[model samples]
Target: MLALRDGQLYVLAPDGWTRLGGPAPASSTPLNREDAEDWCEREGWDLHLLDQVPQLTA
Candidate 1:
């Protein structure tokens, strides 16, 4: 899922945070939804915005 938090964007998975962008050099620079779409599409995936990201359990 795509989550915008603290003025930055992150990509998350069931395990935890993962790199964004597809098959490209991973970037720390945040990506907005539109750019995210292009990235995911390149990998044959779709970007979906989540209303909330569940807190990670420590």
Candidate 2:
């Protein structure tokens, strides 16, 4: 599922954080980055850039 608060978007899953589909809302919908981050943090999750991960090749 998806959730919006302040101006950010969040993907809810049974496990840890899912993914960020878009930036904070600006027009029709409502989203909050800070709130989302806070929620994730509260849930022991972190928002990180995939690029930060080491590249893998097979």
Candidate 3:
């Protein structure tokens, strides 16, 4: 699954979310990994991703 955490794009993986690069409508480079499970208890991963969907352009 795809998501955004702190303005960067992320893709879900076996271990955690890996940064796919962006703040979108911007640039892309240097992907990284951030442990996103912490968010599962807070606002929920689905909510987080939903909030950012409008920020993306087709």
Candidate 4:
């Protein structure tokens, strides 16, 4: 699963929570699911397919 905390993105990996990259823009706009998936793909991080993970709230 993925989460945005403190303007940064993180992905839950087997080893533990791993940071994906730099901080996100401090704008009102939020990252969508599709974009996050694409990012994980480019970063070579496996995206989990679980629905129990809670959504990230602003």
Candidate maximizing TM-score: 4
TM-score of every model versus the real structure: 0.38, 0.34, 0.35, 0.40
Per-residue lDDT of model 2, residues 4-51, tens digit only: 433445555565335476664455444366765666577665555211
lDDT of 3: 0.49
Clashes of each: 0, 9, 0, 0
How does residue 46 of candidate 3 score in lDDT?
47
At residue 57, candidate 1 shows an lDDT of 42
Can you tell me which runs of candidate 4 are displaced by over 4 Å? 1-14, 18-29, 49-58
Residue-wise lDDT of candidate 4 within 5-56, one digit each (tens)? 6566765676756667866545535557787677668877665632223345
Candidate 2: residue 4 Cα off by (Å):
7.2
Per-residue alpha-carbon lDDT of candidate 3 for residues 1-58, written as tens digits (9 for 90 to 100): 5666557676655555566764543443332234433444353554344333324444
Look at candidate 4 and tell me the lDDT of residue 28.
Answer: 34
Global CA lDDT of candidate 1, please?
0.53
Please give the distance, in angstroms, between residue 22's alpha carbon in candidate 3 and its true position after superposition: 4.4
lDDT scores in order: 0.53, 0.48, 0.49, 0.60
Candidate 1 C-alpha lDDT tens digits along 1-58: 4555553445666555554544333555666767767776776553442334444445
For model 2, state the Cα shift of residue 52 in Å. Answer: 12
